[model samples]
Target: MTMVTPGSSPSPDPDLVQTILLSLRRKQGTWVAWAQGCQTLQQAKLTPQQIFEETGFEPIQQNQIVVAEQVYQSILKAGLSDKAQAHFDQRGSDLLYELRVLSQADRARVAEFTLKHGLEADEVRELVKPVKEYSYRKENPPGFGDGPGDAIAFHFWKLARQKDDLQDRSRLIAQGLRFADSDGARQQIETLLTDFTVVKEQPAPTLPLYRLETETDLPRIIPVVGQMPLTIDDLKAVPVAVPENPFGMVTFSGTGAWIAVPGWQVIFQSEDPVGLLTRARQLPNYPAEAADEPVLVIVDRANREWQDDGYFLVAQAEQLTMHWSPSPIDAPILGKVVLILRPKRILDEDYNRQPWQLDE
Candidate 1:
C-alpha cells in the first residue's frame, strides 16, 4: 500500500503523468490496471482532482476503483480457477465492485459464481445482498443448502410465500427454482407452485367523502335580559359557536380533490356506528397530500371483542388510538375501525395542461 500525500509533488514527472493519462483513456478491458495506474499517480502526491483534470476520471470513479481493486486482489490471493481468472483479467470491473460488500471468502465464491452464470453488473449487485444478509438471519431457511445459490433461492422463496397474488408468487417461485442448489430446496419451491390455488380476496368497503361545513343552522344564544333594542354590531359583539355534529366529517380543500370511492358500503354487523376524526398518517399507504388532512375512522363501539382479521381503536396515554393486534390489549378497546374515508386526488386536466401551453 503506497501512502498518498496530497499536493506534495516531491519530483514532478510529466512523462509519467501522460503515460497514466493515456492508459486511463484506453478504457477497454483493463480496469484492474487502470486502478493500479490511479494509485501510482496518487502515490506521486497527485490529488484526485488533479487526476480528474488530466485524465477525466471522476473522484467517485477513482474511489470505486481503489476499493474494488483491493477486493479483486483478495479474490486473486484466495485463488480462482484458471478460466475464472482469465475471464476477470479482461473487463468485469463493475461486477467485482459489487462484490466488495461480501466477506473475502464469500467474495471469492461469488466471483466464481459470477463467472459461471455469466452474470451482468446489475445481477452481481442483486446477488451480493442475500449473501451479505444471510449471516445476520437468526436461522437458515429449511431445505436450502449453504451455498450462494441456496442463499438466493431462500431469499426468493421467502418472498414467494409472502405474495398474495398467484402470478407474483409463481414468478418468485420460478426465480427461486433457478437458483436452488439442492434438490430439497428445489422440491420445496416446486411444491408451492404445484399446490397453488386461486382464492378470490374480498374487496375492501368504500365510503363517500364529506366536507365539514363551518356554517350551522342552530339558533343564536341571547342574554336572559338585554337592552330593549340591540344593534347589528351589538349582536355581532357576542362570540358565535356551533354545536358539534353527531357524525364526524373529514374535509379536503383545493380543486380535483375527489377519491373515486363508490356508493357507501356496510361494515360489520353493527346496528349503530360512531366516527372519530384523525390525520391520515395514522393509516398506512396514505397519499402525500392527504397526510395532513383529517380522516373519519368509523367504528362499531359494540364490537369491542378482538377479531383476528380486524383493526380496533384503543385508548393509549389517555388518548384514543388504533390497536393493531389480534390478541386482547391491556388498554380499553374503543371499537373496530370498520370504514376509513380517504379523500381522492383527482388532477384537473386544465391545470395540468397549463405547463405545456405556448407563450402568448
Candidate 2:
C-alpha cells in the first residue's frame, strides 16, 4: 500500500507510480484517481505508449481522463452547490472533458446547466462550442445575458437571422426556444419565426473537379526562378513551360517546373507573375522531394492584399523571401504566394529496381 499524495511533487515517486499502475490493473479506483495516476506516470517521463501497455487505457482515453479531472477540480474550486458536487463526484468524465476548452468560471456554470438538464455527452459536446464562442464577442447581443442558456440562445438566434429559408429559420428558432431561460431571449426568436416570409435556397457548392489529358487539356507549367529582384521583362522572358508529354508521360526536364494548377486563376490574372524556387527543407512540415531539392512556389505580384491565413512574398533587408502570418510583417511587399507544388509520390520506385515482380 504505497501512499502518494496527489500534486505533492513535480517529479512523482517511482514507488507511487508502480502502485498506481498495479491499482489500475485491478480496476480499483475512481476516474479522478486514475487521471492523477496517469498524470503522475507522464510526469515520471513514461511515454503514452508505455503507459498504455502497462495499463489497459488507450492514449486518447488517458487524455480525456486527465483533462476531465482538471476540469472537475476547477469546478470544485469555483464552489459548486452541494448537490452538483455530489452528482459529479464519480461520473460525468466525458461531459467534463468537453468543457476543458472553456474558462474555469464558465466550466462551473456549464456544469450546473448540464446537470439540471441531465445532458448526455453528445448534447454537452454541442452546447460547449456556442458558450465558448459567445465569450469572445465584444458585447452580448440584445436579449441575451451571461448565463449558459443565454449563450446557447444567442447562437441559435444568430443562425436563424442568417438564414433566408423559412425551414432553417424555424428550426433554429425552435432550438433557441428549447434552451433559452429568459423571456427576452425567447421573445426575440419568436418574433423572427413569426415574421419569416421569403425563402431562398443556398447556392449549390461547385466541386473542384478538372479533366486532364496529354495534348488538349494539359496543365500549364510555370518555371522556378531564384530569389532575385525581378523586372517586367524578366517576368515576360521566362517561358511558360507547356507540357511536352509526347508518350503519355509528363516529363520535368530542365530548370525545375511545376504544372500550373487550375485553382490558380488569380495568379494567371496577375499582370506580372513568376515562380520562386524555395528549399522545401526551409518550410516547417512541408515534404521535400530531396533534402536539397527546391520546390516551385508561384506568386502573384499584383495581389498583395494581406489575408491572415495566406502566405506572401516579401522583400526584407534587400532579400526576397516567403512570409506567412496572421499579423502584418514589417517588410516591403513583393507578391502573394498562390501555389506551392509538391511532386507526386513515385509509387513505382521498387518496380524500377525489380522489373519482373508485378505480383506485389
lDDT of 1 at 99: 82
> Ten residues in a row with the worst lDDT in model 1?
254-263
Task: Tell me the whole-model lDDT of each prediction, alpha carbons only.
Answer: 0.67, 0.70
- Residues 233-320 of candidate 1 have per-residue lDDT tens digits of 7776654332233232222333321122223555436645676666766553344565466676777888887764677776532336
- TM-score of every prediction relative to native: 0.50, 0.55
Scored against the true structure, residue 320 in model 1 reaches a CA lDDT of 62
Clashes per candidate (backbone, < 3 Å): 2, 0
Over the full model, what C-alpha lDDT does candidate 2 score relative to the true structure? 0.70
Candidate 2, residue 316: Cα displacement in angstroms equals: 33
lDDT, candidate 2, 308-329, per-residue tens: 5667776532336565543455
Q: Enumerate residue pairs that collide in model 1.
A: 258-344, 259-344
lDDT of 1: 0.67
Per-prediction RMSD in angstroms? 17.0, 13.6
